[model samples]
Target: MAQRLPSAAVLVLHGGRETGAVPPPPGPLNLPGVRMLPFVRAVRRAAGAPDGDVLVRRVRYAHRGWNGGRADPLHDAVTALDALREEAGDVPVVLLGHSMGARAALRAAGHPLVRGVVGLAPWCPPGDPVTQLAGRDVVLLHGNRDRTTSPQATQSLTARARRAGARTCMVTVRGGDHAMIRRAPAWHRLTAGLVAGLLGTRSLPGPVDEALRLPPTAEATLGTLDLDRLGARPHGGPAPAGRR
Candidate 1:
């Protein structure tokens, strides 16, 4: 009999600016469905159900603003993770976060039940070095043309993670801006490939390899289009007719 595929749980946390109640733009950096629903869909497709067993369980939390107050968003995230672990019943867990949420995922890495963490466009705020990541597998994905959070920030964090003894790799998407990845098929492909690899699924080229390439100017202009106009609310709900 074939060995059963190990169950995997995935938790996604969204990032937002500290001041605003409305939340920030969703893009490659944040996977805000308004901005990157296509990429999210691609990732879901890539993390296919394992043969005779479910390979993935997904959970998402999108904070309206930065949890700079007494209630630590990180702690809340850990609590949610613990709940997910209990619900999963011994399945391996993978934590995925973008931007500020990535910071929370990094802090949650030391949890005994977690198998790995993926940080997309992670930004490390000033704090004690992330010592919890030691011995865990981590993948950091960032766009080279990202202006919101520079690649340098990710490089520095990766270096710090390495020094803390974490097994980590940083993948840079070329000619890709923070939000451009959502429009370019390559972004979906890269993300799907990464998730599939982690899930031990058969490797396949992402849709980007065959998608049309937009020039830098056009790519930048794509950001001007308000994703909120796409008819979906921030976390996958229907938008109010007049709101978008």
Candidate 2:
């Protein structure tokens, strides 16, 4: 078969509930709390994205969560990425996912075509692989007020990725929750900026506020510790052995 020429592609993955069942498709309006629609639109309309140059696609999961079972979210992500590569040729892909989807994007970052990954409130537990993402640009955004997935998980994951030689950065949203509905504007700005930066379309705004750079008040109190002691584990297969 004739191969499609390479072009840029942005793959969006959405966070799932703990049900382990398929999620309803996102509505067209991109409403608040809609799995991943808001984020997908944010990136698509980001500043500096050239028309006809970038393709944004969202992954539909067959089941919720990364339970390490057959046809799980992670499995669906891989399948989506594989199809994307086939259709787009050897194009550079920027992955953006939230929560469980974020975890799946991080796990899938090892792919050669993946240029960068943007994880929003990712559920990155200890022991996830960082070596696979060596030398790749990785950005993580988490809300300080998030209870569903702690920002510490992303912090640990970022520390490990740094150790593994991946260029990594983490941003914390003040008073933002798991859904980021509280600081919706901030969430959209950060996500859009990260996507633009990752795709090399434009650089992220600098001279940011101190609060955005630091984690939540409570987590910040516990001075930095050794990440190696955090039980960093890398799964041998497509997904993590345990669910968050």
Candidate 3:
């Protein structure tokens, strides 16, 4: 029998200082530690996203230049998203972004395919403004002790998003840092709860409950090639099958 696709699609945007550049390190050393995959996986599981139905697409913006002056990464992200939507055909999509990526995701919320957006430690871009997010379900998540982006900045952005007429929710991870959700269990729980709510799942009583409900053995199978190992090779070039 053919596999059934998920009803919802997710586009994950990774945060970075440089536009259209490689994503920065995620964990302590700042490596690309599944930036938003874990959260996406958790949400999918909680919401019981059908196999093959739920697709996770990651978009990395190109680095414009040293001055950070260039066409908005959001525009580039939106274009990529448009292609994904065309391929999926009628599936509702959730846009998730971290740091600078969050800002880009917000800017792209007006896209016809987007149903909602989740912004983690989002960074506000100069002149981009939050008005573009009006009428969308926007969730702003941040760590209270985040030194990199600062909670104040997130609050300011959230307020602006709300003013723009977006249905907004702000979640502040207590005693958390820039990478708090990745480090502490408490922060992770908070982040998971927020994501679950956005995905419209019944809230798990706690992190333990959430863990217990996850599939005992689940693995992510890449299409035919492992993009990570292949790096910048052309998409259709000859490549090893199923090996990253």
Candidate 4:
């Protein structure tokens, strides 16, 4: 019921094959679950954002892989992003993608509408160029134990992006695998935190807010709202010695 300034948009892209879209004749069951909806919902709920302040779009690719010639996932994503930009009217857009989609998001990060990118277990091959990501804030989260797409690939990608003048950080998900099914909570927490930080929205409930230890840019509203009761010292408050 309130109007917020500096509106933002989030585009969520899912992994390949396992999360690809169905044919023209579709039903409700056709929804993408492999990684798309879950991530979008988590970030949306965490932000608790009202309409017009933050908008989210779940991208359904034309094909499963980025290599699909005419049906390339990247092309579909770019078209979706263009539509999103037109709808939001120049609002800052944050791209959130997993696996193959993650790689595509990184490639499209150079779009003027995009300000930040969050890649979950992205499939970034060693030789993947990073020039397209220049000037964008990038965060890559990969399961150290991921066999589907080596964590090393994301590490190398981060390194190259940083070298290309992008503010980049790669977070290793300890003992987790590519899907991150076991440590889903932590994965979602980090994703939601990043979304809140970029969109200037409220952080979700529970200990995750304090656990994230997000910067003021992300936690300012949370701090003012006293949402971080688990860690009162986060808002420039006095901390008693020996307090845990």
Model 4 lDDT per residue over 1-244, tens place? 7444447788888776534354322334444344456677877876554454678777866665565334366777789889876665788888998887788888888888888788888988777678988777777777878989877778676666766766566666677788878678777876777666545454323343242333423322222211123242211222223421
lDDT of each: 0.56, 0.67, 0.57, 0.66
Once superposed on the true structure, which residue ranges of model 3 sit more than 4 Å away at CA? 1-5, 18-30, 64-67, 125-127, 181-183, 201-244
Q: Which parts of model 2 are misplaced by more than 4 Å?
A: 1-6, 22-35, 47-50, 69-71, 207-244
User: Model 4 residue 8 lDDT?
Assistant: 77
TM-score of each: 0.67, 0.76, 0.68, 0.74
TM-score winner? 2
- In terms of lDDT, the poorest run of 10 residues in model 1 is 204-213
Tell me the TM-score of model 2. 0.76
Cα deviation at 36, candidate 3, in Å, is: 3.2
Query: Which tens-of-lDDT digit does each residue in 144-240 have in candidate 1?
Result: 7788766666756655665666655565666667665544775556555555554444332222111112222232222122222322221222222
* Candidate 2 lDDT, 61-180, residue by residue in tens: 765556554427667777888998778778888889888888888888888788888888898878778897776777787777899997887887776776676666677676778887
lDDT of 3 by residue, 1-244 (tens): 9656556677777666644444344355443336566666655654455455467667755542112655456766787788887777767677877876787788888887777787777776545677777766666667767878766666566555665666555556556566645445543444444444444443322321222222323211111111122222212222223311
Q: Each model's RMSD to truth, in Å?
A: 12.7, 10.4, 14.2, 8.7
Instruction: Decide which is better by lDDT, 3 or 4.
Output: 4
Model 2: ten consecutive residues of lowest lDDT: 230-239
Error of 4 at 30 (Å): 5.8
